[model samples]
Target: MFGVEARALMLEGVNELADAVQVTMGPKGRNVVIELSYGTPKITKDGVTVARSMAFENRVKNVGAALVKQVANATNAVAGDGTTLATVLARSIFAEGTKSVAAGMNAMDLRRGMNMAVDTVVEYLKSKAKTISTPTEYAQVASISANGDAEVGDLVAKALEKVGKEGVITISEGKTLENELEVIDGLKLDRGYLLTNFITNTRTQKCELDDPLILVHEKKISEASKLKPLLQLVVKLQRPLFIVADDVVGEALTALVVNKVRAGLKVCVIKAPGFGSYRIDHLLDFVALTGSKLISESTSLKLEDVTVEMLGNAKKIIVTKDDTIILGAVGDKQVIQERRDEVTSQLKKATAKFDKEKLEQRLSRLSGGVAVIKVGGASDVEISEKKDRVVDALNSARAAAYEGIVPGGGVALLQASRELDKIKTTNFEEKVGVQIIQIAMKIPAYIIAANAGYEASMVVGKLLEKIENDSFGFDAAQGEYVDMFKAGIVDPVKVLRRAIQDAVSVSTLLTTTEAVVYPNYTSNSNSNLHYN
Candidate 1:
């Protein structure tokens, strides 16, 4: 297919997907009941979840739906929220772009103009963003992201307070009816186990060890002789051993894998975090935290000469494909504090942004602590749904802390649309692109109002009348116009900016496309198929 016909079919698909997703846009938005392949049907207000569940029988339309789905996923991956808004924006932009193209507008010029408008909107959002530092501010952001769940907001606020801005906050299902938050002393590393054979929990794809003896090595271990003594010592002690090393290869890695598989020894190996000087600093931090000796050439410590006393101890160690978390580390408080102080001192003196960030991460790991929010519900499906919301809220809270926030309920985007009028366009096609985005920005607030059973156009018009006050927006739940920020309705600038960026990126590509190709399956084709 080519030209208007192809674009029209794609736009229809975009509309179908967006129509289902936009309903779940605001606090008063309706929940979508999704039929599952097994067990109970899933009911959720998460836009990305709804988008992921949708498929079309028409291949051409399915292609369009898939592109919109990519926008949602990309937004989710970056900002962890605003996926619904991203989908809505993508559909609006592509639909408008399609109309312009059909009217003899240059597709490339439209794309260029769309990019310019988006960049301007992003800058406007940044200028208008307000940095949030207090726990109350965090709760407000969390509450809005979780669809006005005050309980979730409170839990997330508590979690962020306990963990600090740079610290890790994870969400999990709880055993009880009430949500719970727990703070623990732990260290998380970016590196994970070197081999899948080290995984002890197949269900979670993680290697979990209880009361493990941690061995921190600064250099690679390639010989069996150097590892034999440590294995023997761990076996004699009857304790699981966790190895953090520069690299484990050749006979040394093979020996550990064989011991894990055949000898039934509980052992896991992971590469040390960071690179070069950063790696050494991270290893040093780990050593200080675990009360282990740093096996480095500068210290004249050889792998063969390592003893049980040199190993660090931890209450529990969990290793996954991309990360490792050590909980309840058995380190002296004084030593850990001293290490933290050293990192703090270095952080103050660091001039490079990269170095400062790395130092801040070290300090956070040493002092900020870790928080786990266990989301609870009456049923499995309820728990799953709530957990998703909690995770999104937590991520949004973090993003808000990083890049600040803007008036939400789509007011920010609507106001941003006004700035597009100031942008200079070289051609009529380019001007149409700017107009497309200008119109698209208003769609979110409109859909949000319509979802709450109000007259969408009236709400949008009233809000636009007060464009001078950028924060003024329709409070759909209360059927009133209010200051969004003062009403505790806000969005992270990072989320909003990313949503628009990803939406326009994919939507413009779809707008410019002249043709699409799909497979032509026929009778008597091979039962098994392969793709590359």
Candidate 2:
């Protein structure tokens, strides 16, 4: 008897791991998990993870279980959905190729055939994918399977959409823009010239605007009135104004106030309504008072909500109902303010790349061929275990059918049993392969039932009983649950058709080539190594 090498053990482990989750890839299936660590142990039902871990445990000598590792790694990287496909395809190639090798056929021919089969599977997936056009769709797909908060999803979607529209979206620390409205810095009233200094005098509080330039700092009316010649020269510049302040207004200035809404000039009032006041809460209230978006770090952000772009355009423009610095310009404000439309239009052009119509067209294409079935919300670990059972069934089916998930696992296998019971063949070994494959076909159903906490043999027996009786396959396709226990579609053969095209191609190629080559995977090793 030839001794089982570590390589063979690892390959078998990959087989088992993939076998564990193959059946659950479709809508009606489940997930699987394995807990190797403690203290809120990590868990996953992904085929590659289980197979890799299994390979690591079984191969002591490491006779290139690395290839086994590779297979499991690739499978797991794809998530459990496609790992089963990878394993089943690999195993089928091996099965047929091994036969060919024994019969003096080239193993390379079998590998080439297997490669073709893998390509076919990929082609199928590619055909099923939706063309991504806009960042919104990209964000949608990313957020669809996320575990984070709703706001995070919104951020991602918005960012992607913005990037789709614009070349890049710039983020700022001062005011992070979100869907919610916010405010920032503010000022108060009823005080004198200096905010921090003493101020019993109320006469020097107000400043007038002729050539309305926003003042960033406080300027008394006495000092500002002398700029009569300066006023006429600056007002006609066609520029935006910013007014800053140092102190508050007295009781009499309410009658003398100026910065009206008719000017169409954007103003930035730093210390406004609450300035020079004894109370601080009113300053916060003043922030909430402003209708325009303000953003700040020092004051209440809700009221000071200033975005990055807002700050970028801000000049020495501050004008409050309290007349301190009524009008002032920050370095050639006329140049930017006059050309604001050109700047905004240019920025908007680079911000979002995706056209709305293109996005809609892509969405239209993705609308069909989508089947979203909710699975049992079991614990992550529980989901993993159950999924494993399903995958095992699918892989067993694939191994047995030589191309697809059959209706069984270890118990009588599938293809072998089917051939033994139905298909006739003159070659004894060929008949034997088919016979065992038949029993393997149903291995998954048995495993799923057992994992679901039922007796494997009895559960599978019932499944077959149901399949022998009715047209439940049609019912299942129509979204009707054919409870094999309740309805007669129990044999699990219904699952064997999901990848029929795959099965036909792989099976025919493998049979035609009849040469098996070693698989490359190192994730786990098998305790039970079966060889014929």
Candidate 3:
């Protein structure tokens, strides 16, 4: 167990990580070149990547850094942008809360204040956000996120506009031109293989098949004898087969592997998608996707029941541990429509117990189209950096399209902080919480100013006096106060809200951390390090 010393150590570590990350905060911020021990160096301003690249000699600092990295990861996961801002905000809260904790302020009071501050800031952000409808507004958000790359922004905005809001966007390295975006028909499946045995080509870790027949079965195939007739049919037809079943156990699995590896028969077997009864929906979706027949053991138990006419044909199927994506699927529009209608009706009938995101995603998959922005650069490092920026732009544009936009350049947060400061709170805990967030709000502007070679204190003071105009804030690049929206500097409201919420959560947890227990430390240790 540890007390003051541990807290100080933790704070120092946190401060170090914050110092390393916050430098890459705003548009005026500089890029960090991360040199790995066994790879080419990477140059990026992405906060999450930078934080992950950092190493601390001080064990305490490393521990602190690890905790704060959660903020970056969570922010990236939810909004896909604002990792740096979130990290900075969290550091500020943790720093401010540390002072309060040292002054004998109750941890519970600080935690309570943080919660209230999150609610207030979120509400304030919502109030300030402007609805985004036009492609131009989306372009602005994307441009800012892409580090002022107008081409990337314009391309992403146009792609999203063409594909509609429900459409998916993905990025890949390109061979020609700095890049281009293409819209193609496709669907994403959440079900992926856990074993590599299904992949016939070990060199590429891929199972390549041409016009493979799909078998959607409802029961487990435990015996090789049960699968023999189907295997013989695949051999007779001289075409690859894809079997989707509940489970292919022991002899059945071995037989398929032998037939594929030794006899050179193309066979790929994967467990039917989804969990429990939901697996039925997945199998149905696959049937709709490929226009395959729904074959179940409940309907026919005999091997002869599997006929060539009963199987569906797919152009290609790719599997990975995370997910499976079927490409060039020959879709039956009528069948897809029927399945979509069924899923929609199920969704309408679904209670809160049903997973809404999953259902909605399934519907989107059924709709079927993906826009890919293949980013290209002169060098590997450039490509990597450009890829991150384009992805951020894509995600930021999507968020803006989904939720709307907020005034950026730290204007929204500063405005909310000031508004909270003016709020009259009778309770001491509430007042303290307001004060902590209020102070923390200025951190973004301060860091932005400092990064741009301006006096942070002077810039923050100037911006504070312009509170009358919520849109006006210190534009570090210009070293003057201006309207963030007019300057084409805006962020998705969802990104800011996610950052603030995660920051408050992590900061509150840090404040309540009273001790650091090193599990590996023992009194019997002969090393110099000692703890009591």
The backbone clash count of each candidate, in order, is 0, 122, 1
Candidate 3, 18-54: lDDT as tens digits = 8888887777778889897987999987788998887
Residue 409 error, candidate 2, Å: 17
Q: Best by lDDT, which number?
A: 1
What overall lDDT goes with each candidate model? 0.90, 0.34, 0.80
State every prediction's TM-score relative to the real structure. 0.76, 0.32, 0.76
lDDT of 3 at 475: 65
Per-model C-alpha RMSD? 7.7, 18.7, 6.2
Which 10-residue span in candidate 2 carries the lowest summed lDDT?
A: 365-374
> Between the candidate structures 1 and 3, which one is better when assessed by lDDT?
1
* Residue 12 Cα positional deviation in candidate 3, in Å, after optimal superposition: 0.9
Tens-digit lDDT string for candidate 1 (269-332): 9999999888999898899889899998988988888898899999999999998889988887
lDDT of 2 by residue, 368-389 (tens): 1111111132464444443333
Q: Rank the candidates by TM-score, best first.
A: 1, 3, 2
- What is the descending lDDT order? 1, 3, 2
